[model samples]
Target: MAKPVQLTWLTGAQAIRLHDAGLRPPRGPFAYALVCDVRDPALAALANLALTDADLADERAPSASARTHFRARRSLLRALAAAALGVSPTSVRIAYDSDGAPRVDGLPAFVSVSSRGPLAALAVASSPLGIDLEPFDASAEPVDAVLHPREQAMLAELVSTARARAFLRIWTAKEAYLKALGRGFKRDPATIAATCEAAQFSIDDGGPAPLPVATFAPTMGLGDLIVACAVTA
Candidate 1:
């Protein structure tokens, strides 16, 4: 069985402290994810100093909030990658591939970034990986549009809050798998099937075998947000 991905929730001060200390997550075939608030003032300041000219040129968000989030995510990504590579944060460059997936220049590491509300997440691994975040809505109804037929059938057995929570897990798993595949939503989400059991998840996209997915929720004192990370195993 594949090992589950580990997630770390950090504050702006905590992340900065770790970076300063040159601390990196455990190295191996496994993946790791980090989450933090993008709206924090300390993070914003760190982003302003860490971002390079190329990183700034990539910021074309139409609104101020979008721009701020973009900068924060990029800065966080650079910091994490730099720590792993044991280099200066500003020296690390991030570029997007043709599929719009972010890549760390000159490194074999794979990365994915996601945000929901005030929080942002980053996933890193030696292999291709993806991460997704979604705000859980207690009043949400299961939406069949993005679910496979099998998934719809499974969700139909649940009611009210149970159904809503199940839908959130399935949704994040499918989305994360798609991102990991570097296709994102270009491929129909309904074609991907996801099964959730407690903190574990499995995704079937008509592949040779079901892919393992790891999920974390109610993290960092935010009970309303759900996160999922997927990698080809």
Candidate 2:
């Protein structure tokens, strides 16, 4: 089981617009992340149009499919940030810091962006956070070298299909935490011990941290993708 995700599904236009919606921290137990399908021709067009000259250059620098993915996700990312901050979409500039984590200019909130194929995700919180979206593939490698001893034990208890789900779920959670740490995969996965049981995932990331983490299947109706979000405790 994973924490329930209270997702706000934005239309392609809302995702590309700058409105009165301004940046605010999520209240209560609910953590927020915006998800959109950029594969839609309409959304893709808006995303391309939303791109700044710099964004276009970055998009063009990637391979064909990746270029499109980058543009779509970044487009939505800008719109989401702008809406939250009540600013023009073009006024919201995204710059990568030394760690390569995306930051919205002049905002104090922590932001994370992820896209798999056409589905894109963005999370904004007052504390440092990370969010990841990964499609489940039984054939993909699980556990990898990042497996914590406790997580390995948890996996050993599952069999068949359940085993695969648990493996991917745990991986997503761990990756999310690493992102929250602001270093991404630049750190060893083993650096944070991970275990998933029931709907909650816990980790001993070697800290006396103060934020909680939530992992859940997204409500975007994207078939078999799983999402996990981590925020400061």
Which segments of candidate 1 are over 4 A away from where they belong? 1-18, 25-27, 41-45
The lDDT leader among the candidates is: 1
* Candidate 2 global TM-score: 0.81
RMSD of each: 2.7, 4.4
- Which 10-residue window of candidate 2 scores lowest in summed lDDT? 1-10
Each prediction's number of clashing residue pairs: 0, 10
RMSD of candidate 1 to true structure, Å = 2.7
Error of 1 at 49 (Å): 3.0
lDDT digits (tens) for residues 119-177 of candidate 2: 87787655567888888887654565888777777778778778788888888887888
Q: For residues 9-113, write the lDDT of model 1, one tens digit per residue.
A: 443356667767767656655455666776666666555655778898988777888887888888878877666556677777898889888888987677888
lDDT, candidates in the order shown: 0.76, 0.68
Worst 10 residues of 1 by lDDT: 1-10
